[model samples]
Target: MVARSFFALCLAAVAAAHGDHDHDQDPIAGPLQALWYNTLPGDGGTQADSVFSGISTFGRLPYLPCLNHRGINYDIAFIGAPFDTGTSYRPGARFGPSGIRQGSRRLNLYGGYNVPLDTNPFNSWAKVIDCGDIPVTSYDNTFALHQIEEGHFSILSRAPKTDATKKGPSLLGKTLPRVITLGGDHTITLPLLRSINRAYGPVSVIHFDSHLDTWRPKVFGGSPSEVASVNHGTYFYHAAQEGLLRNDSNIHAGIRTTLSGPSDYENDGYCGFEIVEAREIDTIGTDGIIKRIRDRVGTSNPVYLSLDIDTLDPAFAPATGTPETGGWSTRELRTILRGLDGINLIAADIVEVAPAYDTNAEHTTMAAADSLYEIMSIMVKRGPLSVMDGEKEEDL
Candidate 1:
């Protein structure tokens, strides 16, 4: 009886302490602020006191395991493909997605505004969210490729919650959401293109890289196994063969890599891409390059943009799978991307950013993040492709 009474007193004391202990009050929960704000942090907490703090998503966007979660739809979703076995040179590009997100922490700190485009892409009409990274297996390259394709297709097929009533674009009588993938390597584009082709048919490509990436497997020197052929160097060749690319409508910008021979250029042409050499930025200027790209791709067809970070000069972005000298400055590339504001950009990727090779200042990852920000702005400005337009049809 005495021990039972002591236990009862102890329990009462614990209850009293629990009842008396005060928890820290939420700053935004004050009466006036409460009227304007909800429990969910505005701008995904980018406006937090420190930029370096918090879970990192691109531009500090909201993170959702969108693939695993049903009914969580978005107009523009950011998904990471973190497989790098397809890389021929450097191996750390599997970390590209996290590196790019870390670099993008400051993108929306100032209300997510872009003075050049005169818009805040984050606050725009589209429902933008970070879909988190696709769980790609690193064990097998072939299985990883299929995993990426299935993961991307899962997100792309969902109907988005948009600010506008009209659906952006459709192919098989269903409206599709847009995807901005943080890449594993240039090889990731092949699977991405396959998934996009299912929804939009063959898409015109705006490929920005230091290499053509369209080399034939034999010419590029792959093994006897067919699976061995699909590396970063030759995914576009496979994309072309798979009928995923719109022939005669694709373009490659910032190419400056040395080839095996002149026949490599011939092969690139045969794969249906017009090249805007990196050296042309000096001779024809950014305006001329932009015009060439716009003229080649036009404005109505669905286009996929694959950006390899090596497209920037090593002086600017040294941390890539293959760093080539004498490429475009980040500013030059941004200007050209801004000039492409009205094109029908359906999906895009920023690839080959190997942060292990980056400087302490993180120039390569920053360049990749900023370039993706500009692309997002352009997409927001262009809105979505209207379903009724049809002038982009060309012979395949």
Candidate 2:
């Protein structure tokens, strides 16, 4: 009780201070449109700006996240969970989200279908913003888990959850913003899913990974024990036991590994929707994959996409702990992302981008950033900028 009360007071104080700061910074730049630096070729990094310059007036800023278009402020928070403690082998994913965001300098607002940019369809209904990283401890294992659990729940409350917007915040008449997270590793998704399930009923997960993380007690040795297996290897099994996942709707993509989970597949379930090898990418392609994804998850269901960096080929994403050789290329992965535009995706996480493996640090973070852009583009196309001042829907 004391901890909850103290946290609540801290939140109120932080909110008050943020309100004052936003009021000051926002008036300088009225609306956030993708600026010129974004469109111009040969741009170095994400350029932070207080004013909209260049052509089209839709330059995506680097430093500042979330925009207060019109009178309402959208909470498109981009939080980083740099947690590598749960990892069994490699352990530098804590820097994954930030590294990706840093590399996402030029984001494509238009879909590959060549959707006209001047009149993009998705801007009206959504208002996206990046809230930055949550407050968490770095080294302390127990403290990190507690912070990841509590810290994310607070951010989750700010999201629209089931409805398009949330009520009860001081933001009042406007819609509460949606929070997007770039996780440290796959374990971060467990706490995040728990928070979302508590707010909204059982949600479907569209997971993309190289391995099946459904083994409850991961054992890598002769049998499935802690000595053989560890934390990062078993998320799906834990989530299912915790009842945070809807087994029917969950879909796993770009999987090119051999997993041996006995009862997880539900009589040949394939350990939560496994797509072995590059065969799916070759035979069905992105469109076929998208259709299959939509078929499994359905269109209207809210989705939380957890994309492990190992899903990409080692040539493209070489910074993961377990890198499979014949994974899909980056462009192939991007095509899958663009195909799923406007499919009720709530939040996303790009995990397992270990910077240490890549001496150049080019492929891993770059691929991860590009994957994150897919979610950003999907959200942007869903009317993030076009949403008007909406009264909080009580029933929602």
Candidate 3:
């Protein structure tokens, strides 16, 4: 009886202490309250907060597994193509992918630039992952391009396997994740187009560069014996010849370079491209340029946007193999990209970012990263993965 009374008293004492304890002062309770009440940090988290906070991928997202890994699916993948051997002037573009990734560290995933874009691209609009770099051989150009094509094929093949008999909208028929390539140089676009053509057929291109890139192949380095010698300048010519590009619909913007001859213009014209010279931006203005692009590409065509860093004037983006004296300013480029909200953006790349020429501030790389973010925003707004069942085709 005496021991039972003592135990009862002990229980009563424990209850009194529990009731008197300050929840705010309690370590476990305080953290729980903070979880509910604290403002979310913009840089993902503080350095000491989580190991993942410091890990680097584009936008600091988790690394994606290889496509062959069973049951894995991604809506978008950032793949690096780090080859510069095809460059005619400078060669440091091999470092472009790394430089762009490094520059992206300053960006916050939660807040995108305030534009007319409807939603934050990373806000569950699509599933995005970094697939890392496509391995490229430094010595063998032909073999390297083949490897890039094969790597891209592997990523596209990951789209969910569908019924061969089924038919519908091209966007709905797609099962593969869209890709954003960080380039070694502009030559990488040829292999990229080859991969995309296998699935979406010949796509319309939105080419932005200081040079018309459609110069005759032989002018750069091609010969009858070496017909395959495709440099950055001649890839689009080859792309058009191989039936990998929609001739009449494709357009080139920001061209400022002197052509090899009048025949270069004739060649680009024969390829079915309309040219918008860099100086034309001052005359036509941003809205006019946007209208021209939209009218040319239309809503149904699957479009690939290729941005060469030299499209920006050397004053704005100096870190390129071929810097032009007069080109679009960073603001002009960003605004133009912002205007392309509803077009069907299947795949895109930002190329020719040779970091070796950048200033101590890395301004060129930073501009490239911002341009990539803008493209991603456009993709989120128009990509098939983000469309609803009843969504209008124009909205997509």
Query: Which predicted model would earn the best TM-score?
Result: 1
Candidate 3 — which pairs collide? 159-175, 159-176
Error of 2 at 186 (Å): 1.2
- Residue 344's lDDT in candidate 3: 78
Give the per-residue lDDT digits (tens) of candidate 2, residues 1-396: 999999999999999999986774322222333565567667545543322232221124333322222232444556677787778677888877666664553343322223432222223334444555666676665566667766666665554522344332222333344566776877777777777676555668888887777755634323345323335666666677677776678888877676565453442253345443456878877788888888887766666788898988998888887788888889888888788765666667778888778647477776777676666666655533113223222221
- True-structure Cα RMSD, model 3: 11.9
Question: Each model's TM-score?
Answer: 0.86, 0.69, 0.82
Considering summed lDDT, which 10 consecutive residues are worst modelled in model 2?
50-59
* Model 1: per-residue Cα lDDT at residue 27: 28
Q: How accurate is candidate 2 locally (lDDT)?
A: 0.62
Encode model 3's per-residue lDDT on 231-325: one tens digit a residue.
79889988988999986998998988986688888889998899988888888999988988999988777789999999899999999998989
**Which digits, one per residue and each the tens of the lDDT, describe model 1 over residues 4-37?**
9999999999998876763532222112234334
Query: What local lDDT score does residue 364 receive in model 2, on the 0 to 100 scale?
Result: 76
What are the runs in model 1 whose C-alpha is more than 4 Å off?
1-47, 163-168, 386-396
Off by over 4 Å in 3: 1-53, 67-70, 113-115, 160-172, 222-228, 383-396
Q: Candidate 1: which pairs clash?
A: none
The models' CA-based lDDT, in order, is: 0.86, 0.62, 0.79
